[model samples]
Target: MSHVSSICLRNSAFSLLVSVFILMLTACGDLRESKVDGYGLPVVQIEMNSETLGLLLGQVTSKRPVAAEVKMQGDVKMKCEVSFAGQSSLNDYRKSLNLRACKNHPSEQTRFRLAAQNRDKTTNRAILAYEMFARTGMTVPTTELVSAYVNHDFLGVYLLTEPISSEYFHRRGIRVADIYQSKFGNAGFRKEFSSNLSEAFDYEGDGKDNYAALQGVYKTLWDNLSDEEFERRIEMQIDVDNFMSYMATAVYTAHWDGFDNNYFMALDKTKRKLIVAPWDLDRVWEKAFEFNPADFLSRNQLLFRMMTISSFRKVFASKLDLLLENFPVEVQLSNLEMKKAHSQSALAMDKVNGPDLEASFDGFEEQIKVWNEKIRTFRNTIAE
Candidate 1:
């Protein structure tokens, strides 16, 4: 009887130890999983009713928003409206999303964009663009690399960015009389494109007729006035210094889509001048490092008119020289490395577009070198 009792006691002790060991392993695993990586990029989880999600998924091309709930760790869970965003990315398997916090929400930020990065294999192009722009003292959207989940499924890495809105300007203490976003590719300030001006730009103000001012000042005046008068009118309507900086940044970054489209024009309430801001920078840095600065002037009438003015041309050259001198190549490379490390796991898990996405870092250094050389050559040519 004593031996049997001893055997039972040992078995019971062994069982209890095994259970405790399993529990400890689970706790450690959980801790490891919870550890934030990549400079503490937050996780944003969105939940929505199945029916609404289905409706959203059904319309690939529609911009109509659907109701949903958004929750970011350490932030208030709020009701939000979700919609498909981006022109070319709409058909992508991993579609970009636009989220707007419903009115009366406690959150300070009302609108934001989640870039799918479907075309950006490096996932850092937009981020690099914004960083470069910010270095030049340009107002750009703040961005973060985040792991996004919807309906309890991991959707992969997303670039969480602030949308250009009233809130965006308000945060920076900027007062704008009007805001217009270029919606179509024909948003150039040319008399030929003026007919489609309404289709090209979406005005955020009360009166659509306000677009006539933009046309009259930037297009009609250029055609009807002498060079001196046109320059005077242009300087009054547009902040020439700001515009020059914007052009320099756009050219240096190879932002092919930004000059006439994928940009915002805000009329400053104080200065009463139009300020250009860049958006959708994903298309940059992909082309070969061989482009003439002159090529850009021909594409937009506003650019052509500005470049024709000798004084404005000098300003633009100065801005370009300043940009090239202060280009943060090493810092940008380090940023790319950090983002790659942080997003590696998510990218691997991105079954939709990950497999097709090439490893962009392999040629990144060489690309940067070539770009720098080309830009320097162009600058020297322009100097002569």
Candidate 2:
């Protein structure tokens, strides 16, 4: 009986040791799976719901399915909820989806790190544009950075956005054939460029007129000219001048920033008309001023480059003329607030981590120079 008991004890001891060995290996395997770079930091994954994004931005774009994803490199993660609006067949995707305004609108995602990585001066310009667009009561999405994180991982920043069209449609109402006629002219007749400005505003001058800026800008254009056939000259200049401003801005953008993307078109829910949405704005004039003269002058020299500049100038020149003429004198005043904005952004960027932050706007001086030249031309062309 004593011998049998001794053998049972030895067998039990062997089984316990084996169990301990298996447990040790299993724990090590788990540690390996969780470890990244052997730092023992668990990897984290984060995502943004298109449905939630659609909700926050609902104020800008119509209810349509839109989406985006969030990722992290270091300790920071960001999720930007952006708004969307669409145009008919702007690209292959549009053609494939046959997208329209009320349906799926084409839009994009944004990261605040971009603003942080670039020169503060350049960054603030975009913020100003977005602010002005909103102030002008056209349409614009909210621009903001969001914060989140998981465990030890830091999710740094993202954007909270809405469509620009939401405000545009609310104010502009619907597209009138007459408004198109005034801005684009009759494709059918193509006889001469004629604009129906009066139709755009309240017929009784309650304020909003389709032909809103006509008389004011007409006078300005006339005054600036040599009075050598003022009406005809003013008319001719207005046709292409506004678009030149857009061209100048675009060229500056190409020279200044290395980025992917450009402007967008939207549907005005109120007027059911197509309109332009501000987009891919990371490229801007201030940055362009930092470019070398040779490359800078001929920046954005691509297949559609000329088209981009030409179309913008053509469309807005007429409006600029009319606006100058009709715009209230008090509203013509300017402000130095841009200086403050630039200073503030610089301070913020100084707080950002990763790669030498001061060098963020390395090529900025050149891009700024090029952009200023364009501005000079723009100012010179302004109707007296």
Candidate 3:
């Protein structure tokens, strides 16, 4: 809750390969071109609720596929692609086929939708939350709120978005140990993160480090595996470390589905290579919302506890400052807003998690807007 300045440059960017994207792209041809001029990238347009714009634009990536966004409300809605084309994502079908995916969008785009039910409305509250966050100057993708209608039925709001490549750092071709050594040779991850950020901007995770691969590292350290397996195990183990570090940042940012955000790619912006980038953030925020409401609560899971404890924090502390700063305002705010919304949803879910989910989604739309405006006002009041 306290504005964490030191965490502005928490130094936690890296590459992660994504299974979903790879799977989808395997067949090829489903890219959506965007209207934006500066960057000639393709964007995925989904129906977005203006209220949750920040939530919609978590982090944009500089993938081979660029992103553009549009938001809809009123009678407008979005469509999804059921089939694959070249390397297109679902949004491609929306534009090519001229379909609405938000509500009344065909079943191919949205499986959860019902005849009279507009399941994909992007509530006004959600849009506001997203907008407020974008203004914060975090690295969020472009956003838009779209309208929805099914078979001529009116569905309220939806979101348009540009997806960032989940793997940001690995694509950059930098090693974690190299990054750590370059910044703070002797220091551990957390300490070096603080030191490096205090000096300047640094958000790359070391490629040499892998926590998940710790098992593999142990295998190598103890000489228990075959050569090829050892190499593969070490590689995966390094990623585990990277994943854990990335997850640690998520706790601070309160992102979810970030596990799915894991994708890495490298691009040569200039002659020099950059670190892996466009990390998909998950668990945007449950903590802030949990802190907000009187009736909200979650079971204290041990793994989560371990994630937030000092030991975890110590490992993640260094990257904390830079990551927050590096993160776009919308990305940060969306998580904050989502936390509250999720809590409220949780409360409602205790009543019922499924069926009639639209009402619950709509109810929180306004909350997102209010939350966003408040942040904007606070930032404006600051002596920036």
Candidate 4:
């Protein structure tokens, strides 16, 4: 298991022990009420039957189907199945959730993700990243801020997001022949692993062997081919523009966890080329960006190899410049400031349930300033 997963498992055990202690305290006639209140964001009230709620709580590691009614701002009501979501967020006191099969929703949107945003105290990184991608003309999931609650108990502010799927492409007037979500930690395109490549990609499309063409591309790219031939063939299969935009976004945001597994690939039928869809963006901008630009991309060998080519390297560098031009530090700070204003009040109430209630938001603000400086320094270094 991964290091984070191990920590999560240990945390889960500790949480269970804490729960037992709380029960004991209650039994001794000493009880404390939870002090969580809804944030100013639109409230997502989920009403689950007692049996279904118990079932959901019981299946902490696995997803259990629990019937629930979800209402947003007292307007949109959905009858859906609720399941705990995410790798580490499942272990959180306020767990992230996945809602599926909401009434009257499009088939592609049968599911929605409510991210816990635990890492980002600002709780705007994912939303900011998604908006940045859209501003750059990339197809990405739409996100909204919502205050989620279960059975009258306020959970906290969550980012309600649409999932990347074939239906997502259809809605955007793009036809996807195939889609694959890269497996975590196994980002390389190794032909020797072709037999099980399908398992790694997590094939999301209809066809049985849609990964066959992708495997062939991987073999041709690595095994034997002139640079010219390889570039021509690879360009035919993968959209270079899309790839550049994705890499630029990752670098600009200093997303350490982005490249390898936190992305999806779709075959756009019109272009007959692969397009990248970014995912799991909450960890971006965790610190000042000062590492070698190459360090950001060392994990994914395909992109690493492409960078060795002068022409591809030039395109990648140009994309980075364009990203810096388009998303300046001032613009990003303004966006962050707006989001902070909208969420700070909610976060204040929400933090009462977590350990960071005493922490100042000034630290987060300082980090943002550090990020802006890092971006400028990195961009200048790259230019030189």
Candidate 5:
């Protein structure tokens, strides 16, 4: 009787253990499956010290970068600084992120930008703008979609890009020291030059603030001189081709934020020339496309000054026409659709109620139709 009872008890215990194992397996399977759609894109899993992250997020003015454990693709782990980035984006429904190497990662290879793309609604503008700029023979940041998780909380699909910093220059073998970022200010050349707001034009890299070169260039542009003198001096100070190409892209993309607010000037001090670069293309392909391109540059004085020069105006007009003729809108839209397809599931799962990414794509398609018609009208106006 005792042996039979013991055998029954043992069998019952085994069944219970089997049931538990099956339950555990099912739970693990769900966890793995939930994040499966997140494949194809790099998964940036951030392990944040809750207190440190809280402090970073709660700060009003002083944004102290906090350390986090960053694991990419479930393999590479590095210590990185996580900080809130952008002006309006900081106050927006979704805030952008700036990551830099705090420790362990290489100093010259560790900064990355993750844009919120809140205003963009479509989340495609940044990528489209960057690609368009790159197509115009400009050195722009490499961008991709990333599924970001902070302490197991899904932050949804983010536009992960290489920040235009010293690291960016190093990768391209460009020796640039004095890098200044543009910010909110009067779009006049003199105003931009004299802007003392730390947020207006920030010095990048660990180099000494060398404003002498930039100031000298500003003085040349500031002076009222003969068209020939102005053209020659401006060309000497800037990469005219790059500037024109940037302008053309901006006009084509209808990037209202491009000219004055969202750009960086990288000075090759030895060459004494500035390379204009694009940034923050989240506000493109909208109302500007419907309005006059000339009207869009209401505050950008440099371009206004250049418009007065017939020779420069002709070249600029030609560049705009060429970009309009060659811009691959269809291909770019296709690429955008592909990216949205890849990132849709993860973005839909965003905890912060990030906009309906799929619906935004539809809106983007409609905007493109409007943009095409407006562009044709602009071309016609310019022709006449």
Candidate 6:
């Protein structure tokens, strides 16, 4: 109870409070330094040894991957395998990259794709297109614009996207019996266009022969059937609503490469029918404003055949109308503006594919206006 004892107790409490304050300040400092951009996009930092880097760069034609380490948003370093992604993109100075977390890593998703956006001037086409698809209730991979670095070298802004795989469907709680991806060349449903099924679609299953019955049914659906019979049979093979949504979105976005190529089909076991999803939307929004969906459909025999069915045509028109109503031109233009503001700093710093950011945005705005007008005109004809 002495005065000195009281003073000692007070001093101890003050010191404890000071220690707590210092700890709080240190925690805040760590958060402030984390790898996030002004727009809340994660900055991915990849580090590889000089020898491994040389191996990846030298073998541009090879799909082999090399070991590397990745750190995202100040998280713990994780072991990953890195490989050069894309076919023609390898020829570009700013090459795309694919990353897969090692088994020991603590992440749920193992694979990720970082698109170089070399061909896109604005560097926002794929991200924006994915957003549009998501809004329309279409199954689309998660996409974001990220600033990327490899071995302390800046690779500028890249589109970080989810690759289609079993892991992707598993995350969404969707079960599938088989998955197939359509590559370039004759990817349509015309039997004559493709020498065999494998030529058009690459079966992503362990054994292609396992799905022989399903593949055979798909190929022969067009042969020896009345229009009514064909509709009944085709409905068993593909989810009509899902396919219509995909086609509508493709037409809406002017995804020129998507109709016959750059698409995926998975056998949805729960629905007992195949479901379609789009991939590689970098070529979207590049078509002229006067784009014709009919002309686009003519290239794909399956789509052209479906258009012959009155019910299918009605459903597709309805889907397209819904998309236009839900995602208006004003909202789209606003999104573009927000994205441009968010990515201006990163785009400005892109040295390899130095994009004219402002010019690109202006061009995108003009194209969007024309594209919307074209689709709206088509919608009116459907109404007529």
Evaluated with TM-score, which candidate comes out highest? 6
Alpha-carbon lDDT, every model: 0.69, 0.32, 0.30, 0.69, 0.67, 0.72
Report the C-alpha lDDT of model 5 over 127-233, residue by residue, as the tens digit: 87787787778899888778776655456667888888877877887788778888775333545455443545777756577665567666776776788898888
lDDT: worst 10-residue window of model 1: 13-22
Which candidate tops lDDT? 6
Clashing pairs in 5: none
**Model 6, range 234-307, lDDT digits (tens) per residue?**
88888888888888888888887788888888888799888888888887888755566556776567777887
Q: Cα lDDT of model 3 overall?
A: 0.30
For candidate 2, lDDT tens digit of each residue in 20-85? 223333332221223222122222223333234224223322424334333333443444332322
lDDT of 3 by residue, 16-114 (tens): 111112222332224433331111111223322222222212221222221122223323334432211111222221211122222343222232111
Per-residue lDDT for 34 in model 5? 39
lDDT of 1: 0.69
The C-alpha stretches of model 3 lying farther than 4 A from their native spots are: 1-140, 149-153, 164-248, 256-283, 286-315, 322-384
The alpha-carbon lDDT assigned to residue 289 of candidate 6 equals 58
State residue 350's C-alpha deviation in candidate 5, in Å: 2.6
How many steric clashes between backbone atoms does each model show? 0, 46, 111, 0, 0, 0
Q: TM-score of predicted model 1?
A: 0.83
Error at 63, model 2, angstroms: 19
**RMSD versus native structure for model 4:** 5.7
Candidate 2 overall lDDT versus native: 0.32
